[model samples]
Target: MTASPPAHDPEPPARRRGRPPRTESAGTRDRILAAAREEFSARGYEKTSVRGIAKAAGVDSALVHHYFGTKEQVFEAAIEVAFAPALNAPEAVAEGSPDAVGERLTRFVLGIWENPTTRTPLLAIVRSAVNNDTAAAVFRRLVAAQLLRRIAAQLELPDAELRAELAAAQLVGCAMLRYVIKVEPLASADLEQIIARVAPVVQGHLTAP
Candidate 1:
């Protein structure tokens, strides 16, 4: 009888697409997130693609999808990192005496834009959000929905959420004009000068009777 054909080790399980070994998985996922941020930063939400992010990360496009699913999800994941500092706004508001809540919040928000390292990605996200509804939704969810809700909860004002949103709008508009649009004296003004001029207005919104 012919010798039975030797088993071929089941073809090594076909290597299972995008399934890095457990130890490698975290690194791989982090790489994809980093790539996603770069891509979204460069291309904006409308133009960025999963394939481009995958190429940047040196992985298959399937792997990006595997980690983050849809392009919007990837955009959301990417901006979450850039917006992380802003996420602390509520805590900053809550920690200070209510008398200076506005200054604390203003300083916190502007401080984020003042730093070159944090400013770049935020500028990208702001541009994306300004131009794209999907990106705007993500921005609102991360900033308005989260930060405003917490500030409102902390302040307990009759119009606390509204006040929080107004405060956010003030800072956001200032940031856009200064950082993203680079408009005139505001952009050129001293960081402390901007903080002093803007903080009282922000405080007024939050603590007005």
Candidate 2:
């Protein structure tokens, strides 16, 4: 049998050299986002460029575009990553009875802002948004698309869209004054106090007839 036709061993699978494949696009996206955040914080949105971000990320400028499209898209992506942990607020709020949703929402949002880790990146975004229309637009789109839309869908009130938008405006305004602008009493006020004071107002906007 021709020496039993020496057993043919299957070729060893190709070994992937270097780092293992990145399974999480979010991780790669987040690296680009962190670099963008630093760049925007340091250079301001107007001065920040894709090429700069690409250089910071150790990737080609084209790769940045491939991942995020335009600069506006990159800014939006950065905002999403920065605020992603909070994106579930609407669903969380909607889970409980309507009457208590606002309190839950308030607590959630305030907790995010009060946490030092989340707060730093958030503050950076807020500062950039205030100084640059591009950043502001990106912020607006993110809120409208992610937060407000989800809230509106869960709300059965008349003009739910308007209500969601109004609630977002109120919350964002409070954040601006308290965190970004650092207005005196609001800035120094304890988190519980702010949540207790603001939750009812937000609740009225969301659930009142």
Highest TM-score model number: 1
- In model 1, the worst 10-residue window by lDDT is 1-10
Candidate 2 Cα deviation (angstroms), residue 17: 11
Tell me the spans in candidate 2 whose CA falls farther than 4 Å from its real position: 1-20, 23-29, 58-66, 131-133
lDDT of 2: 0.75
* TM-score for predicted model 1 compared with the true structure: 0.86
Tell me model 1's lDDT, rounded to 2 decimals: 0.81
Give one digit per residue, the lDDT tens place, for model 1 in 155-180.
88799889888988899999889887
Instruction: Kindly list the per-residue Cα lDDT of model 2 for residues 125-150, writing each as its tens digit.
Output: 77778788888888777777888888
RMSD of model 2, in Å?
10.1
Model 1 residue pairs with clashes: none
